[model samples]
Structure formats: C-alpha cells, structure tokens
Target: MIQLQSIVKQFKSKNGVFNAVDHVDIQVKKGEIHGVIGYSGAGKSTLIRCVNLLERPTSGKVIINGVDLTNASIEQLQQSRQKIGMIFQHFNLLKTATVYDNIAIPLKLLGYSRQDVEAKVTKYANIVGLSDKLASYPNQLSGGQKQRVAIARALSQEPEILLSDEATSALDPETTDSILDLLLEINEQLGITILLITHEMNVIQKICDYVYVLEKGKLVEHNTSIDLFTKPQHPTTQKFLNTISQRNLSDSLIEQLNLTGAVIRLTFVGESTGKPLIADVANHFNIQPNILAANIIELKNGIVGNIVVHINGTPSEINAITKYLTNNGVQIDMLGGTTNE
Candidate 1:
C-alpha cells in the first residue's frame, strides 16, 4: 500500500548537509505489518515520517496507494493524510480532556455530529479495550490505558494505515505485550496496514510479518522475519538477530580461542532439529563428542537451534562427519564457547 524509492531527507546545518534518510526504498504490502528497526540516529523515524509527509524528503518520491504525495497539493495531502493515522511514544492527549473527548477530537475535527461522534468514540474505545476508561482523565490512567486512549483516538478516524513511532518504547514489558497484541488484533481483524518504527527487535519478532533493517539511513537488509532470523546477511542485521536468537561461535571463534583440536557447532532447523544428530554422527565417526553449550530458538514456523560441541577424533574422521552432516543439510560452525552479546 506504500512505496518509497530513492528516498532521501537532508537538513541544512553549520556543517555539510545531514542526510537523516539516504536513498531508502521500502515497499509495504497492503494489510501487512511492516517493521522498520534501527539504533538511535539510524533514520528510522525519518523514514516513517516520510511515508505520510510529516517530514518531506529532500529528494525522491512518496507514493501512498496511487497518489504522488511529494507533489500533491496541501489540500490533497491533508485529505490523503486522513486515510493514515499516527500515534506517538508520548500519549499526546489533552490533560484536561476525558478519554472520551480525547478520542472524540478527531471525529469532531472531521465535523461529525455529536451523537455520531459519541457512538464512534465509544466503539473505538471498546476496540482498544478501554470501554471503562472513557470517563477517566489522562492523569488518572496508567501508561497502558493512556496508550489505549491514544489508540482509540487514532483509530477513531477509521484510517486504513497506522503509523506508530515508538508507541511502545515508553511502556513496560507487560504493557508492551498488551499493546502489541492490540496491534495484532487490529491487523488481523480490521486489516489496517501498519508501519511500526522502533529500535527493539523483540517487537519486530513478536508481530512484524516482514522487516527492513536500517543503518546510517540506508536500507541494509529487508526480508521476511523467519528468513532474516534463520540466515542473517548483513553484519548489523546479524547483531540484531543475535539479540533474540541463540549466539553460537563459528570456525573463526574457535581459532581465536586457540585451543581447538576439533570443535564444530551444529545448527538445527524445523521439526527434526531437536532430535539427536550428535549420537548418529558419533556412531558413524567411532568417537564420542563432548557438547559444550547450546541454544534453541522456537520461531513462528519452526525451530532454529544451535549446539557447540568439542570433537575428539582424527582429522579425516571429523571432516567426514562434518561432510555427512552438511550433506544432511545441517549447518555446522566451529567454536570454543558461546559468544557474549
């Protein structure tokens, strides 16, 4: 539903031009939750802001649905923006306004009648699980409830696209889960296309169907969550994946340790992964392998696991075992011990 091409955003400063976003291309399918993740100053917020023209790009195009947002008139842009809703890290609600009025603001702005606005705001509040909070003020509510009020306000517009800028960053883990679950329900139930901007991989892993990894304002990696988790290509992407996945060392790690007679790490995937591949390999090699440390990842579709083991066998025999395992489509790495985050 959204397409960005060669998108760049630069600001004039005392120094040379600063590119908050640099030639980033992202395509978010309709009704899919697309996540953009990066560390601070990585241009994640700039990229999302570019989607709805909150931050106009210095160069490149912003295409939403079929409209060319870059060159659209102010009125047209405002009209198009109504189709997209956004929420922020802070609740951004009027402190004196009741939850009902906070959610009713958008409806009132759009010129809805009092009865219609009341009915819609009540419905939205219920959707965000805040039917009882309509009478409460922002100061009287918890962090989660305030966010639910923000969500109710955002959704009150009946937007097709929802842009979340660190919506859960300010919440606790339990509250974060609730908010993520609500987003999931909105996507599954209402088919609202979501563009979630955050620095947390755990957030992406939890709900994002697809992800775009941004570093230094560049689109370094983009793929399905499962594919990226299983085989990370970019080094930055690998680091982020390791935060959630099990960390195992490779042949280089073992070599760095400088105490490897024979050491190999085995990776497990899918249903057969948890089974004993070690025992079978040992039987074939006529040697018992000493397992050091292991990590297991039960992903959305399947499990991607890793185990580090110290091999004690002849070079030719161990090589034969690695070949056998590789032939079976198992990933093997050499390591001394598990690497630290």
Candidate 2:
C-alpha cells in the first residue's frame, strides 16, 4: 500500500550537508503492520514525515497505492494526505478544543457537512474507546486518553495508511501495551496499513509483521519480525535485540568458566520452541550440554526461542551435534567459547 524508493532527505547544517534520511526504500503491503526502529537522530521521524510530505524529500519517490506522491501537485498532495493519517509521540490535540471538536477538525476542513462531521467524530471517538470523553478537553485526559483522542482524530479521515511516529513512547508500560493492542485491533478490523516508528524493540516485537532498522539515516537491516528477532545479522541489529534479551556472557563469567568447550547460541522458531530440543540434542550426540541461559517469547507470528549452552565433546562429536541441530531447524551461532573444531 505504500512504497518509498531510494528516498533521501538532506539538510544544510553549519557543519555541512546532513542527510537525516539517507537513501532508503520501503514497501508496506496492504493490511500489514510495518515497524521502523532506531534511536534518537536515527531519521525515523524524518522518514515518516516524508511519507505524508510533511518534510519534502530531497530526492526519490514516495508512492502510495501506485500514485507517485512525490510529483503530486498541491491539491493532489492535500487529497492524498487525507488517506494518510499520522499520530506523534506527543498527542497533538488542540488544548482548548473538546475531544469531539478535535476529531472533527479534519473532516470539517475537508468541507464535510456539519451532520457528517458530527457523525464521524462520534464514530471515531467510540472506535478509539473515548466516547465518554467527547466533551473533555485535552488537559482533562490522562496521557493515554490524550493519545486516544489523537488516534480518534487521525482515524476521523478514514486513512488507508496510519503513520505512527513513536505514538506510544510517552505512555507507561501497561498503557503502552493497551495502545499496541488497540493498533493491532485497528489493523485487523479496519485493514489499515500501519507504518509505526519506535525506539522500543518490544513494541516492534508485539505488533510488527516486518521490521526495518535504521541507523544514522541509513537503512541498516530489514526482515520479517520473527527472522530478525531470532537471527539478527547486523551489529546494530544485535544491539537492538540485546535490549530485550540478555545476549552477552560477561568477561568474568567467561574467565571463571575457563573458556573451555563451545558456547553456542541456539535459536528456535515455529513448533521447535518449548520442546526438549536441548535434551534431545545432548542425548543424540552423547555429549553433555550445560545450558548457560535461555529465553522464550511468543510473538504474533509464532514462538521464538533462544538459548546459550556449553557443550563439551571431541571435535567430531561437536561437529556432528551441530549438523544434527541444523537438520532439525535450530539456528546456531558460536558466541566465543569452546568449539572443538
């Protein structure tokens, strides 16, 4: 439903030219929840802004539903934006306007009739679970409630694509979960293509079908959420994964263990998760497997699992065990320990 082709957005800084969004391309299918992740200054916000032409790109194409929005005229761009809704980290509600009016503003500006505007406002307010707060002002609502108002306002236009720029970052963990759940519901029920930006990996893990990792304005990595989470390739990607999982064996632990035998990181996906894969592997190879650490989590796609183990055996036996696990669909990575080979 949305495609960004070789998109670039550069700014003239006192130091020199800076590219906030470097050459990046993205494709989000219809009804898919796509996530973009990066830390502060990662260009995620700027890239998202390019989607709606809020920040005009310096080069490349912004295509939505096969129409090149990059070359669209003012009126065309305005019309196209009607189908592209955006919400921010901060709830951008008019402080003085009531919830009802805040949601109605877009429709009203589009020349919607009073009756139509009223109907849309009420409908979206209920959709975002804020019908009771229709008369409440921005200051009267909690952070979560204010976000609901922002969501209602965005949905008032019935956008086909929702761009969420750190929409849940300001909420507490519980509230963040609620907001993520709501986004999932919206994607399932409304079939809106969602492109969300977040610094939180857990948020991406919870809702994204596909993920794109950005670093210093460049697209560093892209993959299905399950694949990326289970076997992240890039160093930057690994760092992001570390936020949700304990990844490294401390120098002290390695030293205390004498760094003998092979320490392997095993990742399991699909039906392999929660099974006695480790025990089976040990028994099959006739090798002792000392489990160092393990983590398992359920994602929207499937169960993903990771485990670290210290295996002691002859070189041939260790090689055979690795092959055996590979045949059964376990992803393995040697994390600096002992590999007889």
Candidate 3:
C-alpha cells in the first residue's frame, strides 16, 4: 500500500553534500508488518521519515495507494497525511493533557463533533489498553503507558498506514515486548499496514513479515523475515542476525579451546526443527556430536533452529553425516570443519 521509489535525501554538511538516505526503494504490502533495521546513523530513522514526506526526499517518488505524494498539492498532501499516522521513539504526548485529551486532539483538530471525538478517543484508548489511564497525564504514566497514549492518539486518526520510528527503543525489555505484542495485535485486528524502523533484531523477529536491512543509508538487503533470518546474504545482514543468534564461534576461542575434528553450523526450519536429526546423525554415522551453542527462534512464519556442533570423526563418516542431514532438509555451514560433499 506504500511505495518509496529511488528515494534520496541529502544534507549539506561541513564535509559537503551527503546522502542521509541514499537511493533506496521499499514497498510495504497492505496489512503486513514491514520492518526496517539498522544501527545508529544507518539512516533507518531518516528513511521512515521520508515515507510520510516528514523529510522530503531530494529526488524520488513517495506513493501511497497509487497516489504520488511527491507530486501532490499542499491540500492533497495534508489530506493524504491524515491517513498516515506516526509514533516516535520518545512518546510525543502533551504533558499538560490527559490521555483522553491526548487521543482526542487529532479528532478535534480534524473538526469532528464533540460526541464523535469522545467516541473515537474512548475506542482507541481501549484498543491501546489505556482506557483506565485516560484521566492520567503523561508524567503519571510509565514509558509503556505513554507509548500507549501515543498509539491511541495515532489510531484515533483512523490511519491506514502506521509509521513507527523506533517506538519501542526507549522502553525496557519487558515493556518493549508488550508494546510489540500490542503492535502485532493492531496489525492483525485492524489490518493496518505497519512500517516500523528499529535497530533491534528481536523486535523484527517478533512481528515483522518482511524486513529491509539498511546500512550507511543504503538498502543492503530485503526479504521475507524467515528468509532473512535463515539465509542472510550481506555481511551487514549477517552482523545483525548474529546479534540475535549465537551462530558465530570466534576462531580464537576455537583455537584456545582446542576443539577437535569438524565444527559445523546446522540450520533447521519448520518441521525439521522438531526432528531428531542430531540424534540420527550420531546413531547412523557412529560419530559423537557435541553441541557448542544452539537457539530456536519462533518467527511469524515458523520456527528456525540453529545449532553449532563439534564433531570428531573420519572424513568418510563426516561426509556421510552431512549427506544424511542434507537429505533430511537441514542446512549445513562449515564453520571450521571438514568440507562436506
């Protein structure tokens, strides 16, 4: 429902002109939660801002539902923006206003009747689980509660597309999870297309259907969340995935520990995650399998299993085991191991 085509946002600095967001293209399908991820200064925040023309691109098309926002008139852009809501890293709520009023502000500004404003404010406040806190001011609420207020305010606009610019970054881990869960529910129940930018892979892993990896203002990789997690192509993407998965074993650590035989990384997807492939390899190959590190990630699509194992066996035995595992739909990476044919 949202398309950002060849987007470029440049800024004049002491060093000369630099692209905060380079030529990037992103398409967010309707009703799907799409995530943009990058570290600080990776241009993720700038990229999301370009979506709503909050930071107009130097030269690109910002299309929403087939309307090129870049070419839209002032009135048309203002009307279009009403349907695109945004929440920020810091809960941007009026401290002087109560939660109810905070949510009602948008409706009131849009010239809704007093009764209609009350109805929408109440409805969205409840949707964001802030019904009871409607009377509370910003200072009286916790970080999560404040974000709920922000969400309620945004939803009160009845936006078709929700842009979350690191909305959960300021909260604690537990609060972040709760907020992410709330966003997932909003997407599923309201069918609002969500485009959120976060540096946290855990957030993307939890709710995103598709993911776009940004680095130094460039779109390095974009793929289904499942594919990105299982098979990350770019080094930057791999770096991000490593943050969530213990798939990397340092060469020095391996050397210091003097790990023997072959060291391999195994990836199991879907039903393979439930299989006894490790056990089968041991029994069938008559080789010992020592697990170094492992983790199971539950994605929106399915479960992904990652295992790093140390094995001691002859070349023939290791090859046989690799073949056996491969035939059973397991992905094998030679971490520091005998090459598998």
Candidate 4:
C-alpha cells in the first residue's frame, strides 16, 4: 500500500550537505504491520515523515497506494494526506479540548456536519477503548489514556494507512505492550495497514509481521521477523538481536573457565527446535555434553532456540558430531576451543 523509491532527504549543514535519509527503498504490503528500526540519528523518523510529505524528500519518489505524492500539487497532496494518519511519540492533543472535542477536530476541519462528526468520533473513541473518557480532558488521563486519545483522533479520518513514529517509545513496558496489542487489533479488525518506527525489538517482536533494519541512514536489511531472528545477515542486525537474545559468554568468563573440552553454541529453528537433540547427539557420539546456557523464544513463524555446551571427545568423533548436527538442521558455531568443522 506504501512504497518509497530511492528516497533521499538532505539538509544543508555548516560543513556540507548531509543526508538524513540516504538512497532507500521500502514496500509495505496492505494489511501488514511493517517496522522500521534504528538507533538515534539513524533517519528512521525522517523516512517515516517522507511518507506523508511532512519532510519532502530532496530526491526520489513517495508513492501511496497508486498516487505519486512527491510530484502532486498542493491541493492534491492535501486531499491525499487525508487517507494517511500519523501519531507521534508525544500525544499531540490540544490540552484545552475535551476528549470528544480532540477526536472531532479532524472531522470538523474537513467540514463535516455536527451530527456526522459526533457519530464518527464516538465510533473511533470506542474502537480505541476510550468511550468512557469522552468527557475527560488530556491532563486528567494517564499516559496510556492520552495515547488512546491520539489514536482515536488519528482514526477519526478513517485512514487506510496508519503511520506510527515512535508512538510507544515514551511509555513504560506494560503500557507499551498494551498499545502494541491495540495496534494489532486495529490492523486485524479495521483492516488498516500499519507502518511503525521503533528502536525496541520487543515491540517489533510482539506485533510486526516484517521488519527493516536501518543504520547510518541506509537500509541495512529487511526480512520477515522469524527469518531475521533465526538468521540475521547484517552485523547491525546481529547486534540488535543480541540486545534481546541471551548475551554471549564474556571474555572474562571464558578466561575463568577451567575446562579442557570444546565450547560450541548451537542455534535451532522451526522443526529443529523443542527436541532433546543435545542428548541424542551426546548418546550417538558417546560423548558427554555439559550444557552451559540456553534459551527459547517463540515467534510468529515458530520457535527459535539457542544453546551453549562443552564437550570432550576425539577429533574423529567431533568431526562426526559436527556433520551429524549439520545434517539435522542445527547451526553450530565455535565459541571457544578447538572443535572439528
């Protein structure tokens, strides 16, 4: 439903022209929750802003549905923007306006009749679970409730696409989870496509169907959440995954170890997970395996698991075990020690 082609947004700096968003392309399918992730100053916000022409791209195309927004006239662009709704990290609600009035602002701006505006605002307020708070003001609501007001206002336009630019970054973990769940429900029930920009992997893991990794204003990698978690290709992607996944043994820990066996880390995915494969391997090779650390996380696709173990055996036996694990779809990495490849 949304496509960005070779998008570039440059700014004039004292040193020279610097690109906040370099040449990049992204395609978000209809009815899917696509996430854009990066650290601070990585141009994630710039990229999302370009979608609604909030920051006009210095070069390339911004296409929504079938319309090329980059070249559209001012009137055309304004009309088109009505179908695209955006929410910010800070709830941009008018403090003086009541909850009902905040949600009715968008409809009123479009010149809707009073009866129509009230009807639609009531519907959207219910959708965001704020029906009871209609008479409340922004100051009286919690952070989560304020966000609910922003969401209801965004949906007041009945947008086909929702752009969330760090919408959950300011909330606590429990509040964040609730907001993500609400977004998923909006996607499933309202059939609206969502493009979320976040730095937190947990947020993406909970709701995103696909993810695009951004670093230094460039598209580093993009893939389904399961595939990306199971086998991240880019070093940047690996670093991000390590933040949520179990950390590797530190050099200090490794130095303190007093084992003479080889240490290996195994990653399992899909059909290879949830099995006593470690025990079976030790039994088959007639070698004892000491489990060091392990963790299993469930994703949309399936289970992705990791295990670290130390084992002692002859070179020939280690070689056979490596081959056996490889054939059985287990990824083996030599963390430390001399192990057969």
lDDT for model 3, on a 0 to 1 scale? 0.91
Q: Global lDDT of each model? A: 0.85, 0.90, 0.91, 0.89
Cα lDDT of model 3 by residue, 183-268, tens digit = 99999999999999999999999999999999999999999998999899999999998998998798887777676678989999
Per-model TM values vs. the true structure: 0.90, 0.96, 0.98, 0.94
Worst 10 residues of 1 by lDDT: 332-341
In candidate 3, where is summed lDDT lowest over 10 consecutive residues?
Answer: 332-341
- lDDT for model 1: 0.85
Each model's backbone clash number: 0, 2, 0, 0
Highest TM-score among the candidates is held by which one? Answer: 3
Show pairs that collide, candidate 4: none
Looking at candidate 3, what is the lDDT of residue 278?
90
**In candidate 1, which residue ranges exceed 4 Å CA deviation?**
249-258, 262-265, 283-287, 298-302, 335-341
**Per-residue CA lDDT of candidate 2, range 1-341, in tens?**
89999999999989999999999999999999999999999999999999999999999999998889999988888889999999999998899999999898888888999999988998888988998999999999999999989998899999999999999999999999999999999999999999999999999989999999999999999999998988788898999988888766766787689756778888889977867878897677777798888888677788888888888876677778888888888988877666555
What are the per-residue Cα lDDT tens digits for candidate 4 across 253-320? Answer: 76588555577788898888967889898788878888888888776447789888877766677767
Better of 1 and 4 by lDDT: 4
Error of 3 at 185 (Å): 0.7
- RMSD, each candidate, Å? 3.6, 1.6, 1.5, 1.9
